[model samples]
Target: MAELSEQTGVAQSTIRSLIRGRLKRLDSISTGKLAQFFQCKLDELYVMKWE
Candidate 1:
């Protein structure tokens, strides 16, 4: 987790929040960084559900 955060420039807490599904909205820049690091598309990282 620490390594990912360092490589992606995303905070560990933010990643943890994402893992725990506590984030209500996504930050495009941060999400994009994660997707780039993981070599995946942004949509593959998470899904949006209409409420």
Candidate 2:
């Protein structure tokens, strides 16, 4: 998670929330950053589709 925070420029606390499933939603910009860090597509980050 620290690696993700470092790579994506997201806060460690934010990443911890994400890992713990505490974050109910995320903005597209943050989502994109996480996806890029993981080398995955944006769609892969979410189970439900967003309008």
By lDDT, the best candidate is 1
Model 2: per-residue lDDT, tens digit, 1-51?
A: 777788898889987777666786668788778877878774555543342
For each candidate, what TM-score against the reference?
Answer: 0.71, 0.66
For model 2, what is the error of residue 27's alpha carbon versus the real structure, in angstroms, after optimal superposition?
1.7
Model 1 alpha-carbon drift over 4 Å, by segment: 46-51
TM-score of model 2 (CA atoms): 0.66
lDDT of 1 by residue, 1-51 (tens): 999999999999998887667874568989888888989864655654222
What are the lDDT scores of the predictions, listed in order?
A: 0.79, 0.73
Worst 10 residues of 2 by lDDT: 42-51
C-alpha root-mean-square deviation, each candidate:
3.9, 4.5
Question: What is residue 26's positional error in candidate 2, in angstroms?
Answer: 1.4
TM-score winner: 1
